[model samples]
Target: MGDYLKKACCLLFALTTLAAASPVFAADVLHIQPKQHDCGLVDEGVPATMTAVVENVSGRDVHVSSVKTN
Candidate 1:
């Protein structure tokens, strides 16, 4: 019984850790504006801009090197 409880606790911890490491966790940590949506149409020589909002929950300065689009 004791060993079973220990195994269950370990499994729970592992699952929690995996969830925390997934993209869902990052989405919760950072909020990006202009939420991704399918591009309906496109043409050449057209210009567009996108922005991402990131929160610094760590209270430390963070640097963003670059941003790209497909």
Candidate 2:
């Protein structure tokens, strides 16, 4: 029974590791360029704008529900 329990634990660990390392779990469905941008300086009441390109690399039509920015 002890050996069976040890084997079960090892099998569970191996499955968990394999699932975590799978590309399907790690691959990003959307690719974003220039993840971050720095605007040197801005005056009060002034607006600064930055542009980023987002592409879908998953080879499937993806509907963007919403977008948010900080």
Candidate 3:
């Protein structure tokens, strides 16, 4: 029925969103190498926090998004 289809779609969306938002796995570190600099300039260190997206697709938990460094 139409109502059933609607409910199914809503459930699917909710599940997908939840999976996308959830942090099922985490990395030990999110570091970005700083560019080399001269004696006068300063170099910034690696990032402390970063954002990542995890997805549960095909019933398998996987990291689907690109790794980002802050």
Candidate 4:
């Protein structure tokens, strides 16, 4: 009984401290738009330019570290 009560109190205090000290991170919203282009066919030894327009609607600074395709 006493052990359980002590554990619960310690857990509660730890949670409260963490919540008060931690900073709330806001979500970042970004919009990506691609330009229109016409390509007849994709074949070997073909050159293409991929253009994208990225917009930050979150009103915050966004860092683009890297980009990859699957």
In order, candidate lDDTs are 0.66, 0.71, 0.54, 0.65
After superposing candidate 3 on the true structure, give the runs of residues whose Cα lies further than 4 Å from its correct spot.
Answer: 24-70
TM-scores, each model vs. reference: 0.36, 0.37, 0.34, 0.35
CA RMSD per model (angstroms): 8.4, 7.1, 11.7, 9.1
Q: Pick the candidate with the highest lDDT.
A: 2
Expressed as tens digits, the lDDT of each residue in 1-70 for candidate 1 is 9999999999999998898789775565544445344544556788654445455565545465776668
55: Cα error in model 2, Å: 3.1
Model 2 agreement with the true structure over 1-70: per-residue lDDT tens digits: 9999999999999999898888575466555445545665678898875655555556766777876788
The candidate that wins on TM-score is 2
Position 42, candidate 2: lDDT: 75
Candidate 3: residue 53 lDDT (0-100): 37
lDDT of 4 by residue, 1-70 (tens): 9999999999999999888766443222444445454555667888654555555655666777877654
Stretches off by above 4 angstroms in model 4 are 1-43
Number of colliding residue pairs in model 2:
0
Score residue 37 of candidate 3 by CA lDDT. 30
Tens-digit per-residue lDDT, 1-70, candidate 3 = 9999999999999999888766543432232343443334344884344333333334434443654434
